[model samples]
Target: MPIKTTKKVTNKKVVKEETKPAVEAKKEEVKTAEVKKATKPAVEIKKEEVKPAETKKAPAKKATTKKAAKPAVEAKKEEVKPAEVKKAPAKKATTKKAAKPAVEAKKEEVKPAEKKKATAKKTTKKATTKTTTTKKVTTKKMTKEEQYAKLSLDTCLDLAKAMSMNVTRDSIIQQLILNPDVKSVSKDLVNKYQLTGKFNFEEDGYDEGLVEVLVSKVYETADIKPQKAEDLQADVDHALNYKFTDVVADGEEYKAQFDTMRKVLMIAQHKDIHDSKNLDEEIGIDVEKFVEEFMDLAYSVLKTWKYEDVDYYEHFIYAVLSQLEDLHDTYRNRIMMDVADLYILHGDYGLGDADYGYILRENQIKDYIYYRYASIYEGVDKDKAKQIANQALQFVDDRFTYYPNIIAVLEG
Candidate 1:
């Protein structure tokens, strides 16, 4: 029994030892719980501090997002603006390039037009210079004496002016009385003055109105050498013998008839001058075919009549002029000069109702007409002579070969 009890005590000791170890394990767990409670407060404090910073950062993040969005919108607008600007500059550059070629083309076109204008101006200047030079040459050609040998009333008037003499009616009468034939007297005068060929004295002894009388007077006064006489005579004879084939105011047929009548009248006048008896019956002029020729012959003869023969020929002159009044006469102006001489010099102004002043006023007076008018007015009316001369200035042509004669009468 004692042994059994001791064994039980030892068993209890074993149980106690095990139980004490369990109690110690429970104490350690409680201590761990307390330590966790203390750490919880610290952890809560840290979380509280971190929460405030996180709250502030949330608003900052929102503001940063809004700023980013605004910048993106502005960048989009900037991209669009840059695209438009680049396109506009490109279009402008293209237009400038196109316009440069057009401007260059216009400049090229203007260059040719400017050259043409310059050439035209040069041509006009040359033309004017050439015209002036031609005129100067013509004037210089006229002064030579050899050029004077081509004498004609209408062709070489300049030469006539140089050779013409201003003689009186008394001088002509005296010259005629000295020799019955004025041609023979002219021949003597031409020989005496050593001017046989220069003075054209017709061998036929035909009197050509005032021309014959004037030639004789000029022969006496001219200081020409005998050697030049033949040239002057040939020129004058050629001019007189030149046929009137050119159409005048009348047609060629009328001119032919006029030439024939002039020849007949010239023959009749020659016969009357040499022989006192009228040759109208002998020349068959009073016949029906020659009646018109007869009247023309009588009229031409009256023009060359002496001052003493005016009374004898007054009736005949009236009859011839009255017959001419109805016809469309080419010699109407020439006939008027004879009428004027009769009225002014003689006592016959019997031209019925014809205006002498109106005839004179007609501007149809040419260079040849001026010569006849001036000769009529020379001794009788000096004022009329001067007035008629001054009026003829514009009628003078520069191109005429006989321009000098007309100038001499007007400007003398």
Candidate 2:
């Protein structure tokens, strides 16, 4: 009974705590309820609340809730309804606050997964790019090798032919055949080895293996007999001594002399006059020396026939003069006078013009050389010839014969 009394006291205290605002709300609702008993919905809600409260507030000793306790219970229930309405918005606010974190947590969870997926995509892209680069590098190397392999034998032959234009036709083929990988030889292969020279093919017939055999032959016959200065000098002497008995023979002889002179000129043009050969006994006589020696010999031998064989004299003088240099004054004067005489005979006035320095420095037989040159120029430029003749007159001595005819031509 005591415990039951204590529980009722606690319940009453709970009701009393809500009573202040509830009583105010109930007074407001009662005024409104009387005015709108049939029309207002809040009046019906208040009556429903009152009925439940009356049943709950029955005395503790009664088997059933006592009817005498009804009015107070109804008033208490109306006051409690206002408290429950106030608490309803608070419960909804608590539930909304709890639900907000769950939504945020879902977004946070999805963000990491999306980031991982983006990262995976980037990694795959990088991997694909690397694969493509590696494939391109491999393919490029393969293509270059294949390009070299695909080069045709015809192209090789063409390269050999083109290079042969400068060297020999068979020389290129010979080099290709000598190579261990002859079948693989191409234009670039020949270029890599840098093979060149004249071709001397001795065989009569043509065969596919002919080029290869020639190439092999070059290596076997690579020995060259070093030419001595004496041998070259002998050849020149033979060429200069060539003589003619008649007009037909004279043309042929002159042509031979000119051709021989041309060869000597070609040899003189080489930078290494002696080449690689060591011909120690032959001193001070290279291609140039050989040429000078030949000229002196020709002049001594040919001077007797100069007036009768005008064509031969002209040819011989022009050949010697073509390779002659005006280095030693005595030697130069002899060559110049000989060339000047040839010019007079040939009517080539331009060839007779000598350098003034070369003329002034001539010491041996100076008067004779000056007079002779002056005589040649008299037909072209008489005033200039007279001046030269006057200069020659100063050098005349008892040792020399000053020709009166030279003076007469120069004066005219």
lDDT of each: 0.40, 0.44
Off by over 4 Å in 1: 1-315, 321-328, 347-356, 361-365, 381-383, 394-396, 399-403
Candidate 2: stretches off by over 4 Å: 1-237, 244-251, 261-330, 340-351, 354-357, 361-365, 378-387, 397-412
Candidate 2: worst 10 consecutive residues by lDDT?
276-285
Q: Cα deviation of 260 in candidate 1 (Å)?
A: 19
TM-score of candidate 1 versus the correct structure, residues matched by position = 0.24
Candidate 1 per-residue lDDT over residues 293-338, each given as its tens digit: 4334434444445544544334333333333343214445655555
Q: Which pairs clash in the backbone of model 1?
A: 157-402, 158-402, 197-229, 197-230, 198-229
Best by lDDT: 2
TM-score between model 2 and native: 0.30
